[model samples]
Target chain A: MPRYGIPEYRLPYEMLDRDIDVITSLGVKIETNTRVGSDISMDQLHTDYDAVVLAIGLHLGRSTRIPGAEHKQVCKAVDLLRNITDGDKFKLPKQAVVIGGGNVAMDIARSLARLQKQKFGGVKVTVTALEDRAHFLADPVEIKECSEEGIEIFDARGPQECIIEKGKLKGLRTWKVRSIFDEQGRFAPAYDESDELIHEGDMIIEAIGQMSDVSILGEQLTEDLEWNRGRIQVDDNGHTSVEWFWAAGDCVKGPDVVHAVADGHRVAGSIERWLVGRQK
Target chain B: MTEGHSSDYERLQSKKSLAEILEVAVEFERTARDFYTNLIPKVSKQIRYLVEELAEEEQHHFDLFSKLKSRPDIEQLIQAMVDTPASDQRFSDAIHLPDLGEKPDDQAVLQFALGREHAAMEQYRSLAESTEEGPIKELFLFLANEETLHKNQLEKLYYETIHSGGV
Candidate 1:
């Protein structure tokens, strides 16, 4: 059978780099190390360039609403992966509990397992998720690898709180999940409180989801921009409510390489037509 | 000396089922992804393009293996395969990737890509040979061919970068 899902899947980092090379070769100018509304200023870029496409992706990994969620010991899965990718030799935790069931959670769990195996000569990582094994969002192969690598996974557990004692993260407390979705298929988790369990660990990682860093929009622009259900409103062609500015990528939609790619093409096409209209 | 981590990693590397083979394939792609993406920001502008493209190719391979990983037989096959002994590859520190902040230019990136593609191609080739004519065999051959295509692309790109006065 043919491999890959809709619109074909390609790695993001690689695709961006190679495409940048191709585009640069075609005489397009690109700049890096310039953060929007910070280093270079988003308003400046908007005014300087004829058309601006905000393709910033959702980089901040989501954290659960629980006490001690803001504790230093609690790490975002994206941050952990970013630090690892950005070459940080972080002090490896002896025991870690990753709270999520998605692929990112599996990845962090395995990554921690590798670190723990190196540090203490064994894996002491646990992954807890609200969804049962049958409903886990991570690929089965990833789950299998997690078992092979000695990382434990517990399903049907809803994270109720991050257990912190004396301002130190001690563990993650969770109740048994009865149902993850309601009859309407919405995320309305029902937990069995009597079956509460406190999983002991030195470190806690959150990998539920990710969101965009739109702080760079500044207070005024953020207020001016129209939002759809908390996301920057954009049309099917990625055109925003305001002309001369467009939004796409994870910032507009959610995470997925395919969707981001489609957004890229759409934005490019829209920009082309826009510039053409301006010229005429 | 803590050879345990490396050894355990090698154990994970050992293929037991078609699923394990595909999983191993995904892991290698991840390693390649890490290696190349890390190299991109650190390298000079002249060579960043090459490293980025190489990284992209690794991610592409990762995606393919990921698709292969979702086959119907894997869930059951892995349970039984876990009991088998680990492979005895001498170099066990494969998981300890080089510090990406340094240690690679254009040529090095290409060479790394070449190494990864070669190893994966060989694994897939052997797999294809061992299996009887079926969907499984075809998958292995396809993966192997994918690697071959990458190998060729890297080789040509390597030549271009080298002879073009800047890599």
Candidate 2:
């Protein structure tokens, strides 16, 4: 639990697994490969355990619905990072461009830099974001590493279209971002026409954000549960409206590993306390 | 807000004069080095090592600036801290002293690290703006880039500390 000065952000999947093993060894039971809503039914879980805490994370990547976004070379930033961390190898293009300015975008950019160095002997990566450099949501350190690794950063550029020629990705065409959010704080981007740039790249990765997949909750349970925006609603203790069920992690709070751990602790304590109250 | 002094400093293009810039850089590096050195004794051995490493890096910057200052084309100017008078004597009187026994909390340490990185970034930005020479501009830009990287590293540490619910 003491992660002081530990490089947990860029840790490999196997290292995370090992860390989980260490936690499990400390008398906390951990189940693996058990897919909820598939491996077991909700009714069955309700009958077996007093409370079911859903700690499933946000895995679905937000996509840019620009023209030619369906091109094969265009991939989600999250997928690219996950694949690279899984030790998978592929022949990347001589030049690559990542779109977005979040932490995940930086992670992919840095990961690609490492790959580029190992294979090509130099860095040829570019990151384009809608926000100005100062307003970028990504931790400043990520931006710094991307620059240090020789990646060019083009700020205040919003993707207008993904250029494709003869079934091959040629580059991306973007307009100057006038503003990212609307007056109402919604995600409506205003672009400037006079300022436009075409960034040449064989591959483009989108890292805007991610969303939860609660479809497995089924229509009945989903309708019965309280809602907040598109996420399932839960109390402070990770309790759902239904007494037998709970939800936590990225599915409830979005993507963050430490948050998931905290959510797990809260739900576990709540379940234990509820069970004890029932016994009394 | 001495308008005449501000105008004079602005016109001098202190940024273009490697010697003048180096003087300010040396002073900044010395102050940061002193801060870290003094901070080391107040913390645990692990944190002390980190602060010492930072102090050494600051010393390296001081040495680099000193070498730059010795260049023939360089001209000496009063350091920024000396030129701009502030109520807080800590800014003016701070020395490159060794660490005392006051260990800062994790947040405080992170704040210090952030301030250091911000100063380095600002210094490089000023250097970039003042210098017209190509090589000197490039050098300043490169240093700025490096400072940004350091800033990021510190920020990651800060956020991770917060994520861990802080000790």
Candidate 3:
């Protein structure tokens, strides 16, 4: 996440290097460019190590699963963020319609704005979200900067379809959101279908949420592991159902770097206690 | 003992040309790859996985060196040199799996791996310092970074596996 998730403008590579240097300075050895599942199996980790901690953060971007969401012009904000970070070349859009009201949505929108400003000499990005401006999931600073970059914000809109014309993306059709949650506080959005509008754009980006890639845990291990909702279940100290196995970070908690770091500390303490007991 | 090693390094450094140095590097990578590949089956599944990765990296290094050798401006690339101590195969040669006996424990294997990675890091750093700003210099610097990461991983594994109390 540090390398490929965050933009260089936000968190420079040198800053990351310094942070890593701090750990290496403490005589902590780290391996890079190694995939845990493919490079080393869970079974092997269980056999060899005293304890194994999974800090696999949320990587895959969640889809809105709305109609025409599978259009070629439709993309995920997380994937675009990663692509931008990696300096991967893609056709910069003249007009972009973002489908969410979160930091990730802002990140992609701002990034696209920057690219558009660079390539097309202007910013033409529209952010459409179900939440009202008062209840935006994104940070206020991000929302402010998103406008400062000349991107339009269309709050209180529920995405209905990716408006396509001649097999090409024309814009995003959205309905005016009446209420986002049900009476019981469930995530059932009530939209005023009568109130609809189409925000013209060449691209649509969905940044609603993120989920961890648990396929790395392997089939048997995944089935064996306990889960709370979609997240891996863990004790207060980060210990899992299996005694030697532990989970922390965005995979268990949520998508915040501070929380992940705190989780790391918690897991370390838990593992230390478990190991001491084992030695006894 | 240190003076003797320093003099030996000087002698080797002075006697070798760019092509000859690259040839030695190629040989080093090949040996390291073969060493890791052969050792994989003898170790535990987890260690074997690590060794397998190390072997793959060594092979990559070998390809990089080979490509560097075939570069048209290879001979003229070394415009400057730093007076850093260049590492040879002396450190790696001093250790062997056979010396640890058959069925060496995980700790012993990890320690051995750590030592080799340290040697590789130094060797690449030495190579990096010997060249001016160009692909050769960049390649060695990249290699040095990779080796440092490899050393770190081995050390981390060692601490976690052998000294679980502290980790």
Which candidate has the top score in lDDT?
3
C-alpha lDDT (0 to 100) for residue A278 of candidate 2: 90
Q: Model 2: runs farther than 4 Å from truth?
A: A1-9, A12-15, A26-29, A181-188, B1-167
Report how far residue B74 has shifted in candidate 3, in Å.
95
Tens digits of lDDT, candidate 2, A180-230: 654544443568988989999999988775655565665467657776534
Best by TM-score: 3
Weakest 10 consecutive residues of candidate 1 chain A by summed lDDT: A1-10
Per-residue CA lDDT of model 1 for B63-145, tens digit only, reads 87897677676444443333222221311234346554464544556555666666666666776776677676777789889
Q: In model 1, where do residues sit more than 4 Å from their true spots?
A: A1-19, B1-167
Q: In candidate 2, what are the lDDT values of residues B1-167, reduced to their tens digit?
A: 69999998765542234444455557877888878777766654424456777788778877876766565433333232212112113322333333333656444565666666766676676666665656566656766776766676665554333221111
The model with the greater lDDT, 1 or 3, is: 3
Candidate 3 regions with alpha-carbon error over 4 angstroms: A182-186, B1-167
The order by descending lDDT is 3, 1, 2
Ranking by TM-score: 3, 2, 1
- Shares of reference contacts reproduced by the candidates, in order, are 0.00, 0.00, 0.00
Please tell me which model should have the higher TM-score, number 2 or number 3. Answer: 3
Where's the lowest-lDDT run of ten residues in candidate 3 chain B?
A: B158-167
What is the alpha-carbon lDDT of model 1 when measured against the actual structure?
A: 0.71
